[model samples]
Target: MRTSALREQRHPTLTPAAIGRAATLALHDELSLTPKPGLVTLIDRGSHDDMDAHTFMRSLFSLRRYFVQIAEAGLAGAEFDVLERFGIAAEARMRAATGGINTHRGAIFMLGLLCAAAGAVLREQDEAPRPADLQRALRRRWGDALAQRSQRTSTLPGGIAARRHGLRSASEEAALAFPVLFEAALPALSTALARGLTPQQARLDALFHIMAVLEDSNLAHRGGLAGLRFAQRTAQAFLDRGGVARPGGLQEAHAIAGEFVARRLSPGGAADTLAAACWITRVCGGS
Candidate 1:
């Protein structure tokens, strides 16, 4: 059969490897973003004592193949259990690479689902899926499974914190198709870029926007619910002062980062959400 004919027959979309590359690149974008309150970067370890940029790079290397595998499975219409198995394996590889540090655990779940959904959407449309198309595919395909999964008790600190505080866990966020990513973070990113902000500035705005609203379980895990609320207020204050657009905005953000580090409060959930937003911008051709 001709290439066109073969493409029309089935799975007429991006390669799993290409999809994986997009996912990995998204994570890298998030990691490279500096002055992120309480998050790791190339220059410093934010609030974390165990991991740094090198550790994240190692985790990224370990999970590279896992994204490809999950994307391939989604291309084949594999069930949630299949994707879960891939995630489990990816987590193991990440732990081994980082000497048991949880550098990208939340990312593995959030971005992993996104990559799978991207594969499914690509196979269906024979093109890169838009944010809306991708979200619809994910919820239609695996919403129920994620919803069921969210009910189970979790031993992870974020999950435990979420349950204890009545905030949504990452699983719950997934079960609802990641409103913060699609609704908040992506829009903030697109708007910032559209308004002529530089790439780094736009991403910083998006990260703060997410932090301003998201019930980040990692924040709660670190400093309890009060800590999470403080982070939210701080981020909102930055945006209210014109984000990175005003003269002193960047300095203000840096100051906020210093405060976060001092407090030992890491907004890992918000970081993962930011990564997912980055992935959407890349995969869906968003500005």
Candidate 2:
């Protein structure tokens, strides 16, 4: 397929709720020592007030990255085989470094993400996501691993963290609106994805939209300290401000961070400070 055609075809409709749910699932999938589904609560409990964009993005990306790495090791029976290869000693070491999320199914899911990313961007022209195409791309990307994953015990969730956050004042009416809202929102995500926005960008946009609605509805309280710590860990990779007097200034900070990302991606363009600031607000636990 031509480049434009390929781009158009790969864009899948994703709602804010779906993306949020995906983030939640990815977070739990990333952090849980054992498999569980309540990561949104975990993040609410863990995040703090001083966290920034890089920090927020890092937390999401870090777990997703770990998942991808393990998956790359294998699929199907190979996942457990690799974990067994890690043995008690290796698993202990991983647990110490990671929060104990390194499980067999997590490994398989991570591998699936790798296959998805590769098929989306790096595979042959014919191997993109299509209504009719599934096995072909899986075959090209994972080869034997695809077959193994199908037979394996794990299955990816429909969506994770689609739940609204904890808020100062939430309404029952808004709670019921999730389905309708996300159905409309997913296409925007798909559009952004088609524009070649990185998954990080797409995910970030979805988070921002959620925060906005939650704030409007007064749904939850900020995670405070946990949010900040998550931010600190995430920002360790890039520019770490160490500490800031007031992280809630929103406007100026996002300007700087967005620009930095933009400059990194396209050195000549202006940075995306606005988006970066929004990210900071999230890590800081804004409504």
Candidate 3:
């Protein structure tokens, strides 16, 4: 297909309401995916004792307006500094909703940026944006600011862990336009769907694929480099066994969840990427 024609076919009409609804649905989808290794879901809290599925729901509820507002800001061609302020306020609301628990901090940053990018693309091109367009918009609009932000010192546990272990910080990932989400998670999810897997199965496959490669600071903070390595190996092994396509795959994932919980390792970063992948799929009309 021709490039512009393909974009027209793939991109959906994006409004602030549509963007917020999609963001909320994506986060809910992520929370509903069961047996996510070292992550929270409706059935279990994989590794963390502090939060659960309900906590995540509260965080989602709190950030609904934030997503819409940020998307609106993007449509208005707001600067990076403006978006950052929105994120900060949203984080405060999230913490308040969760009673000081940091459930959706990463999502506030990652999904917020993507939402803004989508809005910007819609306004600039006067058409729906494909995944690639969103990626390009992110870089073209705020890549320099993201890079500069990546250089600042971070006091958060995830940032500290990334720094201490030489893993890419979340800011670094964003500055590079979310290579893991665009390159790995979305592709895995799309391929699974193409192979006739259900949405849940596709998401699970995407989650494992992300866990295999993401330098998840959550794992590092909880179990350090050894823990991170163990997560990657486990995820890689699952994929080697054909991921969610294999017979008994769900059982194997459950087993892995058990192991991750026992080790106190949570792939929160990977989980966030999975959510972002879902958002891209929805926004871009990916089957």
Candidate 4:
């Protein structure tokens, strides 16, 4: 909507060269919205000239539309229910897949809620950090699930190291990526938020931006430990190289994400996405 201004102002961080490199990688990877054959490929052919801010914005939004589909589908009724409910059943499933009681749906839903909250802040222009709303919403839907006790299961096979190898199901992999995605995305969002956008809009905008970059590149498909590592490194590198154009955006998001990884992962800073998601769940509600 603010097309003219967006085009005129030179984004200090995102250089033409950096965006080009990222865009080139995105074009080659072509990770589509749907898991359906060639759907993403079909969508990939559209215009994505990162040279133009309008085009870049459009391209980013386009990717958001698609990733929302993928993210939605990656989580279906069962998985959705598990996360929304965040209870013993979800725990059981995780236990069955991994050897230990590694994660909680409560955590995932909480992350989702944080996304919802941040999305609301950025998009809605609502009041700032309504702890009551967050607590109430979480309690209303996921209260029992969170409260339901977990009967500590056996240790995970491969000592949690094997989980990162990418042999896990798509849903599991996504679960892993959730935290990492937030780690990489949230700080940029926060910086954007400080620039007069609401928290919700800022969060959604940042996520949309990342998804846009991913669409151009195919980061999601390369899902093993190495692949995830690459994604993390790339995100950090992009930030380090001043790709995110905002005052304090890159550093804040990175610090939050780093704290998350250190606290959650088995290794205390396992650079996995799921580990990042776990960390987001705890602090994303504006603590």
Residues 50-139, candidate 2: write the lDDT tens digits. Answer: 333334333444444343333233332233335334333433444444454432222223223332323333223332223113233334
lDDT of 1 by residue, 1-287 (tens): 69878765443356788889988998999999989999999999999999999999999999999998998988899999999999999999999999999999998999999999988886777666789988998899999999999999999999999999999899999999999899999999999999999989999999999999999999999999889999999999889989998999999999999999999999999999999998888777664
| Candidate 3 local Cα displacement, residue 196, angstroms | 0.3
Task: State model 4's lDDT.
Answer: 0.33
Arrange candidates by lDDT, descending.
Answer: 3, 1, 4, 2
C-alpha lDDT score of every prediction, in listed order: 0.91, 0.30, 0.92, 0.33
Q: Which number leads on TM-score?
A: 3
Q: Candidate 3, clashing residue pairs?
A: none
- Candidate number that wins on lDDT, 3 or 4: 3
- In model 1, the runs with Cα more than 4 Å from the true position are 1-13
Taking the tens digit of each residue's C-alpha lDDT, what string does model 3 give over 1-287? Answer: 69978776566466888887889999999999988987899988778889998999999999999999999999899999999999999999999999999999999999999999988987877655789999999999999999999999999999999999999999999999999999999999999999999999999999999999999998999999999999999999999998878999999999999999999899989989999999988877764
TM-score sort, best first: 3, 1, 4, 2
lDDT of 4 by residue, 189-280 (tens): 55665776653334433443343233111222333354334444544554465433556654554453343233221111121222222223
TM-score, model 3 to reference: 0.95
Q: Candidate 4: which stretches are off by over 4 Å?
A: 1-132, 139-187, 196-205, 208-221, 246-287
- Candidate 2 residues lying further than 4 Å off, grouped into runs, are 1-94, 98-126, 130-186, 192-203, 210-287
Q: Rate residue 127 of model 1 by lDDT.
A: 69
| Candidate 1 weakest lDDT stretch, 10 residues | 6-15
